[model samples]
Target: MENSTQINTEKINFSLEDLEQDIWVRLVTGAVKSRNPFHTPCVATMDKGEISLRTVVLRKALAKERELRFHTDIRSPKWKELSLNPSISALFYDAGDRIQLRVKGKAVLHYKNDLTAEAWKNTTSSSRRCYLTLHSPSSFAEIPTSGLSEEIEQENFTLAESEMGYSNFGIVSIQVHSIDWLWLNHAGHRRAFFDYTDGSFQWMIP
Candidate 1:
C-alpha cells in the first residue's frame, strides 16, 4: 500500500498532481476548510507603526490564474490599513494536517466596474450575506446581533446582478509573490517554498 501520509497529503491536494488539477475543488467546495489545520488566515498588517494580525478566510483562489482572493468591507479597519500599505502577508495553518501555506503579496482592492466587481459577481450568496449587514464593518452597534435575516428580507439567485446593493461588495485580490508551503506528514516532514515573479516561478526547499 502507498504510504498513508503521502496519500493524505495528496488527498488535500498537497501533491503535484492534486495541485495542478484539483485546487479549484479544494477552494470552492469548502472541502479544504474542514481539512485545513488552521481555521483562519493569519493576516498580518501594520497599524500605526505597530504590527497586528487577524484571522480572515482564504476566500477564493484561481489556480489557473495563480491568484488568491479574499473579501472584506471597504469600511473595515483592515481595509484602511491595506489601503495605506499594499504589501501584506497571509498565513494559514492546518492543525490536523500539520500543513501551512504562508503567502506574501501586494494586495489590490477591487471596486465597482473594476476587477473587484468581477470577483464579487462570482461569490456565492452564502458569502454575499456578509455584505448585507446593516452596519458598516467594525462599526459600534447595539448589544444584539440580528443577522442577515433582518436586512435582506429574502435571497434570490440570478445570473446577472445590478448596482442596487452590489456597492457593498468588496473583494481583495492578492497577486501572489511567494507561497511558502510546509507539511508535517506522519513520517516525512517537508517544507517547500515557491516564488512567482515576472511570469516565472522559482521553487526552493527550506
Candidate 2:
C-alpha cells in the first residue's frame, strides 16, 4: 500500500495575494495547533562562516508583523550562531499541499527578558523539560542520553521543575524580510516571491 496520498492540484487556483494569505493562515494555524509537519521548519544560520541547519518547532507566527517565533536552549550552538549573525532562513514544506515556503529573516534572541518570560509562561512543563538538560546541546559524552537526569524524569515533572530551565530557555524571533513560495504540480509549478522590505509581490519562473 502507498504510504502517502497525492494532492490533486487541478482544483487549486489562487492569486498571489490570496496565496500569500493562505500560506500565512496555514503557518499560523499549524504553529498554534502543531497539526502538521510545517509546524517544524528547517532553520538555517551562519556559524563561523559555515552554514548550519536544524529543525525547530514553530512556536508562533505573526502574519501582520511577518515574524516567526521558536524557542531554543540558550546553550545550543545555534543560539551562539544567531547571536553572532542574526540573518537566518527557514524552510517549510507541506507535502500534502505540494507547497514549499522559504523564509529569509533576521533573528532576535530573547533571554532573561520580558519576551522570554512570557514565552516560558505559555510553555507546557513537558516542553520546558527540554531546557533542563545539565549539558549544553550537542555536547560530547561517553554515553548517549537525553541529557536530562533521572531526577527530572517525566513522571514527576511539574511546572515548578521548569524553573530550573528558565536560565537555559531562550526565544528566537525572526523578522521576516522575504518569502519565496513554490507550488509543485503535475501540470506546472508556480513560484512567487514576496519582499516585505519593499512591499513587492511578483511571480517568478519555476
Candidate 3:
C-alpha cells in the first residue's frame, strides 16, 4: 500500500508511449489481483438532470478492444441510470504511482445473455450472494439488514445457492472511447490523452 505521492518520481522518466503502456498493464493486472487500488474504481453515470458516482470492482479489462467490465445487481439504481444514458465515465487512481486514469465510454448491459452467463459462471458464490437479497438495493426497510432471511443465510454456500441469484446478476461492459492519464510528480506533472474512437493520442497541459 505505497502512497503514489510518496514515490520517488525522480527515478523514473516515462515517454508518452511508455506511460500509456504502463497504465494499461497496471489496469489489466489489477483486474486479476486483489488488494490493488485499481481493483476498485469510481464509476459515474447520469440520469435526466442528475449525476451519481459509486465505487465498483473491476472484473475485466480488454486492452485490445479498449473495454472494461464490472458486475452489478440489475435492480440497482445505477442500472436504471445506465439504461437511460449509456454514456459513462470511470476513474482509477494509483496513489503509489502518482497516476490517475480517467476513462470515458459507452456501457452495454448484459443480462440473460452469453456474456452474463459466462460472468455469472465464473463469479464466486460469496459474490453471488449479493444478488440473492430479497429486496432491491437501497430500498427502505424497517430495520437495517442484509435483506436475507435467517433461513437463507443458514443454507450452504454452494453453486446450488448461487443459481438463485442468476436473475439479478448482470455485467456492464464499457466500450472505452477515451482515456486521460495524469501523473503528479515533484518536478512537473504530466498529462496525456488517448482517444480510441477518433484514433488520436497526445500530451496535454496538466
Candidate 4:
C-alpha cells in the first residue's frame, strides 16, 4: 500500500505554477512561524572582496512583488555591505521536509522611511532591546559582552524607552531575481528553477 508520503509526492507532481505557488507558501509561512527552519535563512553578501554570510529572521514575504523583508541594525556590517553592493543571495533548508531553496536577489535598505516606521511601530519591546545596544554589532569588546546595557538586557525597558532604538533599526528588502528549489526524496529528487526577471520556469535533473 502507498504511504502518505508517496501520495503527497504524487500530488506535488503538478504544473509549474503549482510548484511556484508552493515555494511562496513556504516563504510566507517562514515569516510567521519562528520554529520553521525557513524562518531564519542564511543571507550572503559581498564585502570588500570577501563573501559574508549571516542568518537573519524572515520578517515578510510578498508573493505579488516577489520580495522578502527582514529587520537589521543599521550599524551592522551586513547592512553596510548590502548598501555598497545590492547583490545578495539567501539559502533556506528544511531537513524534516528534505527541501532546500536557493534564492538570488538585490537588497535595498530602508531606514527612516515608511517601511521602517511601520516595522518599528509593530516591533515588541523585547525585540527592540537588541537595537538599543551601546556598541554596534561585530565590534571588538574588551571582554565578553552582548553590547547591550544592563537595563535593556534585563528587559526592564518600556515601549517608550525602546523608542530610542528606532534610530538604529533598519530593514532590508530583497527583490528576488530567481529561486532554485530542490526536494530530496528517497524515491527520487526533484529540482526546479524559477526566474522572475525572464519569467521562465524549468525543471532540472536532480
Global lDDT of each candidate: 0.63, 0.86, 0.85, 0.89
The residue-by-residue lDDT of candidate 2 on 1-206, one tens digit each, is 11122233575566778777877887787687666867899999999899999999999998898989999999999999999999999999988777899999999998999989988888886787788888898999888788887767563676776798999999999999999999998888989999999999999998
Each prediction's TM-score versus the true structure? 0.68, 0.91, 0.91, 0.94
When summed lDDT is taken over every stretch of 10 residues in candidate 2, the lowest stretch is 1-10
* lDDT, residue 122, candidate 1: 74
- Which segments of candidate 3 are over 4 A away from where they belong? 1-13, 154-157
Candidate 4: residue 51 Cα off by (Å): 0.6
Which residues of candidate 4, in runs, are more than 4 Å off? 1-7, 10-12
Each model's backbone clash number: 4, 0, 2, 0
Instruction: Give per-residue CA lDDT, model 4, range 48-148, as digits (tens).
Output: 89999999999999889999999999999999999999999999998888889999999989999999999899998889998998889889999999888
lDDT of 1 at 82: 82
Question: What local lDDT score does residue 194 receive in model 3, on the 0 to 100 scale?
Answer: 93
Q: lDDT tens digits, residues 1-206, model 1?
A: 11113334634335544442332334343323534434357788777887778877776676666667777877678888888988888786656556677878988887675677677667676666667666777777667563445435356534343234476766777777877766776666666656667543333453
